[model samples]
Target: MISTDNFTIDSTKSKAAAAERFINLRQQKKVKEFLVKQRGYKRPDFNRMILDLSRLKWTHEKIAFVLPVAGASTVSELARGGIPNFEHGEALIELWKSETRVDRVPREGEWQTYKYEIGQLELL
Candidate 1:
């Protein structure tokens, strides 16, 4: 590609990068839309997982660990009536289910207990 000036322009790299970004954004949009629409639709598996975690006394921080890609912020948001990305919600539900099935106290709870070692980790 060339501009009004005599200088030549390489648009191939820029175009590819832009296209990739567009696709990612498109996917995110779709996920968000699906989640919003499913608000009324009941997901028995996901609902059961939430109830089980609550009964087990799992904190939001602990629950957030299930959402590796989504993180704690999204978990908090959902608690406060905020929408989250679909992929994050799905990952969180699935992991929570599996972890509960293999529940091990004093043994598996090692990860559940010492999961968040809060100290010099955060920057102020």
Candidate 2:
């Protein structure tokens, strides 16, 4: 149960630092992709954990180095409709807690399956 709200600019920056610890995992030849689940639970208490996987999709086009592909698609759809969307960012935070791996590439419409965060962007 990680709350995206708790991750301030500083915490997000920290996560960026922690991201370095995972670069090697992605560089491995056997690793087709990799995903780092950095999440937190704050309602009852603060519980944080990081899951390092061997494969993931680097969706740098939509969000940061890591995020949900489906969530990205949803935002793209919303943006096409001329509405602001940030669902993928929230899903990334929640996925960090519950999801342990990125075994397969996310297909379209998958993000709607989860009620989580969206894009991480400053409104223009």
Q: Kindly report which residue stretches of model 1 are placed more than 4 angstroms away from their true locations once superposed.
A: 1-40, 43-48, 69-71, 100-124
- lDDT for each residue of candidate 1 in 1-124, tens digit (9 for 90 to 100): 7676666777997899999999999999999999999776643234334434655676667877756644656566665545446776667556664655534222211323333212223111
Q: Model 2 — which ten-residue stretch has the worst lDDT?
A: 44-53
Best of the candidates, lDDT: 1
Give the total clashing residue pairs for model 1. Answer: 0
What TM-score does candidate 1 reach? Answer: 0.36
Error of 1 at 38 (Å): 8.6
Candidate achieving the largest TM-score: 1
Q: What C-alpha lDDT, on a 0 to 100 scale, does residue 22 get in candidate 1? A: 100
Model 1 / residue 117 / CA error / Å:
31
